[model samples]
Target: MRRERVRRPSGAVPPSPFVRRGRPAGAQQDTEADPARAGTMGSKQIAQETFDEAVQENITEFEMEPEEAVREAVLQFESQGVDLSNIVKAVRPPASENGQRQKHQILLTLESLAGAVAERDAARLPQPLAALAAQCREQLALRCLAGRHGAYPAVLSACQLAAGDRQLLLQALAALAALLDGQPDLLDAAGRELLLRSLREQQDAEVTLAGIRCVRHACLKHEHNRQAFVQGGVLPVLTGAIARHGSAAELVRTAASALRVMTFDDDIRVPFGHAHDHAKMIVLENDGLRVLIEAAKAFTDNSAVLSELCATLSRLSVRNEFCQEIVDLGGLNFMVTLLADCMEHPDVVRQVLGAIRAVAGNDDVKDAIVEAGATELIVLAISHHLGQPQICEQGCAALCMLALRKPENCSVIMEGGGALAALQAMRAHPREVAVQKQACMLIRNLVSRSRELCGPILALGAEGLIAEARAAHRDCDDVARAALRDLGCKVELRELWTGQKGGLAQ
Candidate 1:
């Protein structure tokens, strides 16, 4: 299966807690006093009527010009605690020439919101500011907002200041996550520190989930950020979240995905990456294997969370001992059972096969998996999902690993119709390079040790499929040819140049 990044749903912003309050008793009484001003107390009409009255008064009573009247009206509203931030205080321009003006207006609004967040003593965001922040759900808007001076720091400061209020804190963290989604460089030192602090200190599930998402986005494909986070002890925070919130499916899923991203070396800007080192750190220092395995027990029925946990386990199984550690912790049995139970879910089956394939890297684990009756289940899954190239590929690759060095396991695979399942996969996904290659390797490994099984496998039309794979994909050349040769079929073994003592071969 392809490793996909965990993404928030589109247009998903935190819920705003700042609702418009109803008119106060005094304002209602004022509205009641004048029937002409009815229902205008707390609506937009109130602001317009109030502004027009002030402007008219300024012109008639103070003998002010039109521009002076407008200025005086704005000042009067400001003095009366009316928010004119979103109001157009100048003369209206024609629509044809208003593009740049509209852009400037938007930037001004964003700046006002950011300034509100930056205030240290501000207890909570007002309705307009909170809603505006939530509107930054797209990349362009995020980039635009992030470009403004102090935008990132403002959101981070809001998170810090709103620590006492759960609703306000969630809004700020969600806004912060959106701001840092694809812009990893925007996470400066203070932003990074604030994110770590939030993850470490926050106990609310919603806040923790949002903070974990921020960590994932901040560290994705950014070598410097990944290393910094690891050094700052992010591994424990992630594992601890998993341990603490095993019942919270979304929390476990996001935290597991965050852990998986830490093992990625996908950044192109850096020549060499620390993916292997980070995986080792997660396994050795953080007890990741145990944590994840134990956490998986709580999510037996949740396919999405189980898929994430399984994929993460596959990523962390780098070393032989790590693979063995999974078995020692009873992870192998859990995966096998999960596969059998979730066979109907192609996604879960694919990830379980991958995790099993990863742990089968150890020789002993190979025998143990077979002993656990995985061979039959694997072939059954492959036969069940032949049309899904991901499932077929993972299944075939998994059987290939199980049959790598053990002839006894090869016998078991052949007995369970493993060869037939692989052939079906090859035929099902002819254009899929990974499926074709893995099937070819499975055929080669199956007959590599047991020559007697060659006739039965070749009888299932393995030769033509092998040759077809060899003809179709360049990557399947060696494996396909080896499978052909080992099945006692004639293959043209290419000899480019003879290693003659002289110089060249004609």
Candidate 2:
């Protein structure tokens, strides 16, 4: 393949990678007249010109192996963070031309780079190799995006083992993944397919980690990418990635990060489209939560690992049946036990409390939870993390959910000093509407009847706080007003009835 170039006029400054948009090539002006500075700038420009010329010679000349010369040119381009866009465009075969020779040359170059990655797959790259690999990655990313010699599709095809030498397949796939990211419009389906395949079948932790990284980037800023991932069965592969490394923390962390992203989206499938949530069911039956539990246990000392595991579980516990699945998997008990053991770590406590709230929100689940002594843990979490409004909100919401129609649940809260916990949360976070609302709702449900639990709420003087915070939760003001009504004060219902007359009532 030959690279084309236009001859420059006299004294015309050549384009360098250091050239910025507004700054013309070699337009640098320095006020300082120091000879040292002038010498430095001159040396840099000379060195850059020397490097560019050498790269051009490598690409245009056929003296060396075509693949080796192309690889060397890429390394030179990457050393200075150079932009090969113009050079690539200048040299690329025309679309109308049947340039099989040029395309073949491009494929050879890709295979060479991929084989390098494979050579270093089993262990960390040495400094020199790591530098070369980083440069290779940066160059490949640019080349993939530049559409060189039909490079995009070629790179995509290289993901398959049968594309060429089987030894280089995983490396090629991994390299392609680093390029597929931030390109959802182009790579959503194809990228996800490649990633899922790599994660499920590769069995190499490096390949799985690479796939996990791609999954994170593909899902960035695109809902369609997430749908594509689920549609392509990313969850099953993710579980495979989690268990693939046999306790390698780096691989586990990467896989866990991918799981964290997978569960981050609140809407995995359309609500009314399927009764069973086929995608979620896939995750559940694959023992996804069980894998999370294992990760949480295996990485008890890693705050990041514990945090991601708890976050994934918290998201799963949003739905009713999933909450039960969490309990069945011992997730609820596991989280409470984690809180008891790691209260000093705020991140763990925050996620654990969030998960606990999500799991212990139903009538039956709350009963089992309170019976299992989660009520005390909830109160303790509230007390320990009062400065964390999210923790307080989840704790208070759990209390409200627990006491909804079960006075026995309210009795549990009262006996466990959860009423005081709610009061402390209200006082500490007076400005947080969520905390105030849940705290008020819990108190209202408690005093809604005489379950021998109203005394503690009344004794704590929660009525005024609940009433004052009524406007914070217009959606559930009835609960607040009812608590006031129960305290010998039938709060006005005029606004509650007629407030909807206005457009903003909703």
Candidate 3:
């Protein structure tokens, strides 16, 4: 079955694949001799207009052909020490019969190669297809246009027809990934099967990595494709990739990221998606939690891969049993050490904190996290990176989870100055609604079970901050009000209705 196309909202302009650099067309040019422009002129690259002007001069005055004139213009600019990296130094051919720019030569060549590969013998795949695939991999606009022109089946056909020729197979897979990057709906059933087959059967690390990349791009924002791959038993292949290639960091990282993307319900078109079910399958049926936790042992020194693994662990912790399972598998201790060791790396610390928070959904794991000395480390991480809003948000959230339902953990947070750190985060990131809300929620969780801690929290002017959050963000009203009420601050609790015999209480 074909995936349905998602339509953009009315009047919404599609994003251009090309990045326009340098001065815009018809903008006034600054001369190098201008006193104000001297310092900047040396760093500026040659604009397209200037390059075209020189080419015209070479053609008109020197009587050079267009192609030779273009070549001479490039040499002239290079001799003058002018950077020509951004200029498209080519002779502009006449427009086609339609009076528009011709289709990119690379895309035209890809189309031709697609037909040639399809018509050739199934046993002998042409080598030029691999060459064209390499070219398409470099240009995103060409990849996007190729997808629009129905290039997916041809590429998948090339991958299938490669017939164990590893290099050609790898290039074909890379081309498929580029085409599916933002155009995920182009991934049809045959493409999904090929992706799964490559990941499951291929023992080559490069081919496995390429197939994992294809899966990631295919599942990015397309819920339909995600479900299709999951139904095709991609979970086991993804987890097996890490186990099979344990020492390959790049392969493991890409596989972990692809697994995480399967649990994302980001596509608005598919409202009632199976993201939560997929997470459950990855953890419960496929033993994903244990696989990922064991994989973490190999990458203790690699902060980036560890961060991704931790993030995926958080995504897969969808149940109380999963949370407790992570702890039983020694995830909690590893996370605490990661937090303490990677204190200087904010990204790792943030994801580790998030994982801690997710697993802390289990009440016993909450106490375990605190006992591992994670509470103090979390507070210190927050204090160290007060300038980063994401760290502050995740740190506060982790503390909030640890303090939930366990008053003793609340005492630890207060002793570690968790309250003070959260309030400082709230104050530092006044414009960030997430920081404000999470800090407020932490306050309420801190003081919810222990009323006496409210005095110190209120003494830090939390009432004003919570009230400001309630006033500024509509979503924060209930939580902020609960915080205020628990802190012994007088807040207006409006009663919208009462149990009365009339039709409605107005």
C-alpha-based local distance difference test score of model 3: 0.80
Superposed on all Cα atoms, the candidates' RMSDs to the truth, in angstroms, are 17.3, 13.6, 12.1
Error of 3 at 306 (Å): 0.9
lDDT of 2 by residue, 1-506 (tens): 44333323425776654433222356432222221122133322222223333433555543444456556655544555553432332233313456333322334454454453355332321222223224335543333323333334544555543333344554555545555443434463565676676666666666567668777766654456666787777777777667656387777777666665655443333343321353365455667777777766677677767776777776666567777877777777777677788877777777777777777765678877887788898898899888999889888887777777887777778888888999899889878888887887777777676545565567787766877778655755766777677655558865536556567646
Where does the lowest 10-residue lDDT sum fall in candidate 3? Answer: 16-25
Q: Write the per-residue lDDT of candidate 1 for residues 431-465, one digit (tens) a residue.
A: 99999999999999988889999999989999999
Which regions of candidate 1 are displaced past 4 Å?
1-100, 104-109, 118-151, 496-498, 501-506
- What would the per-residue lDDT of candidate 3 be over residues 96-148, giving only the tens digit for each residue? 88876444455566767677676955444455465556655665545544554
How accurate locally is residue 92 in candidate 3, as Cα lDDT from 0 to 100? 47
Poorest stretch of ten by lDDT in candidate 2: 30-39
Q: Which candidate gets the maximum TM-score versus the true structure? A: 3
Worst ten-residue run, lDDT, model 1?
A: 28-37
Q: Name the better of 1 and 2 by lDDT.
A: 1
Which residue runs of candidate 2 sit more than 4 Å off their true CA positions?
1-186, 263-279, 318-321, 449-451, 471-479, 486-488, 495-506
